[model samples]
Target: MDDDLRERVEREAEKHALLNAVKHESDADVGAVMGPLMGDNPEFREHADAVPGLIGGVIGRVNDLEYDEKRARLEELAPEELAEIEAEDEADEHDLPDLPRADDHDEIRMRCAPNPNGPWHVGHARMPAVIGTYKQRYDGWFCVRFDDTDPETKRPDLEAYDAILEDLDYLGFEPDATFKASDRLDIYYDHARKLIDMGGAYTCSCSGEEFSELKNSGEACPHRDKDAETVLSEFEDMIGGVYDSGEMVLRIKTDIEHKNPALRDWVAFRMIDTPHPREEAEEYRCWPMLDFQSAIDDHIIGITHIIRGIDLQDSAKRQGFLYDYFGWEYPEVVHWGHVQIDAYDVKMSTSTLSELIEDGELDGWDDPRAPTLKSLRRRGIRGEAIVDAMIGLGTSTSDVDLAMSTIYANNRELIDEETDRRFLVRDGNEVPLGGSPPDEANPQLHPNHEDRGVRKIPVGDAVLLESDDLPQREERVWLKGLGCFQYTRDTLQYTGEDIEVVREGDVDVVHWAPARESVPVRMRTMEGDVTGRAEPGVAELATDEMVQFVRVGFARIDHVPSGVADDSSDDELVVYYAHP
Candidate 1:
């Protein structure tokens, strides 16, 4: 490469490094810097191999400088990029890119199509978040379309349709309109007839193996040459239940000699004996394939744009034939790569999760282990956190891997200041007091918010301390908000009530609950169940209220032993741990 081009690449790479380091207050990553480094500088595109080394060299220099130095260098190098960072910091974290050919259209129309075979998983939430953003950006109408056509394989659960709408509302992405593919069977059949009449589609009675052989050999099936009238007649019979399941099929016409076999003639519709879950489709046995049905609906509903995974790029190629035959303008399409959440080890397959639930291994869809939106919500994960985490991913065509820590951090920011603190002693031991202390100790419910109130914990003869937090031999410990204690020989002796002395001596502060008013706390965490003892006030909080366990972590009150208010009967306080 020429010296001028090489110099340009280095300058661009340095700009990203400085901007990244200044914004994050940390060392810039080679992978993180590479995207903008090459994106803004097309001159360096041909030298892809050299870009990483250039970025690496730049990151080292950027990392070595102080935070202020990095900011100053970035402003000096590219003042606009520094200003952009400041603006981004003050605004929302997720700023999606503009739509392609957005200005050419007068109005924007979008859809988030999901198969209602099961409740929405975390991965399924992305489409609505992203597409809804565009809908809002353009003041356009958005539709939540259910692609619940495959009854025999992915049978749509009747409950999932409503459940998905509830999730959208929870995520603040409620659609302006909603519909299902099963309700539009006649629409698909109408398109199929026109397609056959236009000589763009045909019905094949050959077995699956025979068709595969013909397709692999770059040849059409024997029925491919049938006239339009004859083909339509056969298609009608196929839909009229003349053929049993898998006995006949309708195939869309593509390039017979196409190099990619998948782009070659593909199945447009197939017969299935298993009725659709929805009553409207119960009488129908023939179902239109996903691509054909979705493509037709996109045109019929005037979808201006389509967002899909790059893996299904072939759908566009295959569906283009039908569009051309019908002389319909195809909607602008954008393909995004897969998003692999590193936190979830299981594949985001509904069938796999359903089987596990049926086997009694999973405690239904909302189990903390299941990677569904319901699970995250029940575990005290806010809807905003899920939306932010997904929108922050943007619509990159390259596969993106992410850790769930980002979501947890975002959720913490939203709930940390609001949730009141409570003391929970896991696996407790009764420790007697050595001195005559006050009858009770009151700790601030929230350290920062004194106006909220305090937990009036009665100090009896002894206090319940977590077995793990018990003062070691000769070690001094401060029972938070109560008093200091020193463990000597086999006794825990109270030292003094002064907080300054404990801080001066650098004593360990451990959480404790009054032994007299203790309640059995059953905590459900992602790792496993934790049986703990909490102050009586913990059981008084309303269910679903978020609270933080002192020295432990944040958790939501799932259920308090029923009738705790009516009598002295003690019941377990069940809570779900959020995160540390």
Candidate 2:
């Protein structure tokens, strides 16, 4: 192939390779890049057989760059195409369908009852995000009720209550009111008494094993036939600590021959010797089951609609028995399937996460590796991004897998423009500079905006470049806004500020920070810690400010000690890597 033809084909190959890598958030495939290359340059067909060989080295080098570098380079080469991709992705989140029978109620109300075992994860976002959006739509009241009555199993963490409120606030799912079932035991007991008097419930002393056998056989326990007065007396005894844990239970009266064995007179309340977590509720020995307490609380709170998982359809049915017994109408219930967000590497279950925390596998609920909302927040994720991504999943009845990329795309829109561009070279190598480059240069903080005026970048002394970005001996390269330079005779010699030279040279552009303007940086990512040096301006920004590192993705400055400019503190700049 002629030199001119070879150059054109290789440039096209590099652009397509970068585009492919951006799509998958990884290296490009030869098979994929080839198709786009030929389509864009139909004249290359005559050389098709030699095309692969010609573009092989180009594709390999493009793949050799980091995801952020590929993305950044693509931004420069194909700004229009890249912006179109962003516009296309920004619209992927669907607006939720209107609520059914929205006008039938005088007022719309909803409740999210979470068991306070651990911090909320990504899966937990659906309930609050969806409800919060609905709440705003209807001007309805959203309530948060903590299911913390289970003291023995799923013990409530005292800190979790506040943490949940914080998480809710972070997600913009602020609740109109919050309640804990632990604090409402007396109310649950009052309802228990009324049910006994109404002959809708009875105290059963049969052991769990004995009752399971009877329930499965479609036979009532011996205590099932007790009169309301007798039932009330036994219920009071059970509440007054007359029975040990598992010695007795308050069973709602249902059909003895119910088709589903689990619905056959399910236990409403039980004796638990373990004290409650809250100081005010510590005196109680009898605790209500989730279904029983949540049902009663939902009605009392005047929840007009209930949103829950399809797995809890049985619980809704079980609660229906009690609703019917009290001659009360059941709230409108919306059941959705479980959500699967495979993008996050951590386990979704609170129980599992709590165990991991206990075993010292994680630092805490806010560990970057954890899927908790707090962790995402610490990692520079905006709540708007989470809500947008979650709402896009929709409340369908089939298990759905959510791509984290959707969230990243959503977050990029919110943070990319606001954040100033910075540079952080991982495993930094000091590259000698022997150029006519200025001592410092001013560049736009964001590519799309020139008015932000974040700061000017220092460009003197030595440059710290990622080892891979270092040009080989005698190789020419663009210095990104500085100028074109050639690494020859042991130095990166100035080749004048000429864009044509860079294009004609067909050399890779690399980002760098002057050693004088850069400070030691340690970025914490899910994979591991990467040590490097970033622009000192990054440390100057307030902690938690999201900064886009040129060719290095975005990161949130988690820690910036006081007097960093004077080296008065020992703490180094610590940032948490958010996404590519």
- Scored by TM-score, the top model is 1
Alpha carbon lDDT at 198, candidate 1: 86
lDDT of 1: 0.82
Q: Rate the local accuracy (lDDT) of all candidates.
A: 0.82, 0.82
TM value for model 2: 0.83
Q: Residue by residue across 332-382, what tens digits does model 1's lDDT show?
A: 998998887767655677888888899997898888778888888888989
Please list all clashing residue pairs in model 1, or write none if there are none.
none
Among all windows of ten consecutive residues in candidate 2, which has the lowest summed lDDT?
563-572
What's each prediction's clash count? 0, 0
